[model samples]
Target: MKARTESDSVSAVAALADSSRRGVYEYILEADGPVSRDDVAGALGMVRGTAAFHLDRLAREELLTVSYRRLTGRSGPGSGRPTKLYAPAVREVSVSLPQRHYDLAAELLAAAVENSHRTGTPVEESLRRVAAEAGNSIGKDADSLEQALEKYGFKPETEEDGSIVLQNCPFHRLSQRHTATICGLNLDLLSAVTGKTGPEGCTAVLDPAPGRCCVRILPPDRD
Candidate 1:
């Protein structure tokens, strides 16, 4: 299926607002494969009826899909019946950011710095190198910016204001969670592209819209 739209993202989040729905969606998002409603209930500690309710809603929203499979000949202790499983849908139901909130960069950096400082794992250094390399390749053309960022595994789209709005973050996918380290790296790269920092040692993602975002060049930084 095609990528979900901003509107769809909003709807998806709203649909998951219920605690049960949110748990079900998050569980599915974390799973490696599809599961059944009974399995989902057991995994999430939910009653079968409530689990079925959320499962149906998620399926209706296209956040999940269901299918029946052959049940083992031997039924469970109940000796009642056998059925297929309910699993996370075929697609990952998650939010996409056309633009990273400026705070994200700082938050990521802070986390990375703290973790590296504590563990001495060199994650911070690695992140710095990636940012430096990504920054080095950015150029005047919008296409060039997109290409350069893409090389670093960032899917960036050209914004109307000539800045690039990042659509996909490989780091988030890799980590399977949000962190300050990745945000720090993004902040560095963004700073390099937009020139320099201002009030927050960062810049705002200006006028983010369909396939686009905007940025400003810091006075002392490169244009």
Candidate 2:
């Protein structure tokens, strides 16, 4: 799903690189409802043909959805063909070079926060539990620790001293603001994945380094 989303987002972004197409896209995005080609052309000072061309391009890229509706309030035998309108297709677009899963991280944190509020559990404990559950879910599809890490875009690289370091952090931005919370959540998640793949053989430790995730998976006997 993430891979597909990245591909779609890249295509969508590229489609908007044209000034005319970008203008059409932005106009539709700002509109309260679907916008007609005429409305876009008039609003952006573009010719009708130009607007239609760009709108169709955007629709083809899945950036905008096309619909048909009567411009007049009344629709009957006298009503002509419905006017074509365009609106945003996907509410959001997410693309990252290293394929960060901030949405996944945000979901776990938000759920943990809500559970803590409802059940009187410590926020930290709830976060750990939620992170572990999320990790375990992902681990089910992976046959090995390396496979799981790679799948999630951790870019896992083994060091000379028998330790594994993640070259990229999926929750990079969140970790900067909520250091302890997010890092702890990351540690718990990796620990759960590690346990499922290789029980008692490795552990995730909070060992921050430059341009890397705060948590590092360490070989057994190190912790």
Candidate 3:
């Protein structure tokens, strides 16, 4: 999920990198509603085909939504084909190097804290339990532990020593400010998901390192 979201951000950024496309996007944004290719070209003094190419590109990246409408207000064959219109799509895109997921952590922490306060449960305990439940819910439909982790953008990588290292932390931003709390939440989430997969000889433990998540999943012990 995180990988895909990141990829989408990259694609969106690239699509708008062109000055012409960027101009077209801005024009549509400022318009009252959906704008057609002709409208964009006429307003921007761009060639109709050039405007169309950019509009199509934007639509492909989901930056814009495409619809068709008739300007003549006539609904018969003589009314002519409906003009293709471009409108802004509801999307949020953010790109960060090394991938950070502070928002996810903040949301979980906020919910846990609020619920804990209301129920009079200890914060740490409530956080751990809630994190576990969240992981469990994510893993419930997954075919395996790795799949579950990948789906949530953990970016797990296996070491030669039979340990799995998380290459990215979705809660990195939150972890920076509240290291202990966020790390604990990460551990619980991974542990719960791993537990659901029932992978033998594996356990999640804190093993902080630069450029990676703090928790590592170790293999079962040898005799």
TM-score for each of the candidates: 0.36, 0.76, 0.83
- Candidate 1 TM-score to native: 0.36
Query: Whose lDDT is greatest here?
Result: 2
Candidate 3 versus the native: TM-score? 0.83
Off by over 4 Å in 2: 1-4, 45-49, 72-81, 94-99, 141-148, 159-163, 196-203, 218-223
* Model 1 agreement with the true structure over 6-42: per-residue lDDT tens digits: 4665687789898879888888778887777777889
Residues forming the 10-long window of minimal summed lDDT in candidate 1? 213-222
Better of 2 and 3 by lDDT: 2
For residues 111-176, could you state the per-residue lDDT of candidate 3 as single tens digits? 799979999998889888888988787778789888877766779989898888999887877778
Clashes of each: 10, 0, 2
Q: 25 in model 2: Cα distance from truth in Å?
A: 1.4
Q: Write the per-residue lDDT of candidate 2 for residues 19-93, one digit (tens) a residue.
A: 878878888889999999899989999899999999999888778899999998778899889999999987577
Error of 2 at 131 (Å): 0.7
TM-score result, candidate 2: 0.76
Candidate 2 at 61: error in angstroms?
4.2
Clashing pairs for model 1 are 35-86, 35-87, 36-85, 36-86, 37-86, 107-180, 108-180, 108-181, 109-180, 109-184
Instruction: State residue 91's C-alpha deviation in candidate 3, in Å.
Output: 1.0
Per-candidate Cα lDDT values, in order, are 0.57, 0.86, 0.85
Off by over 4 Å in 1: 1-4, 73-84, 90-223
Overall local distance difference test of candidate 1 = 0.57
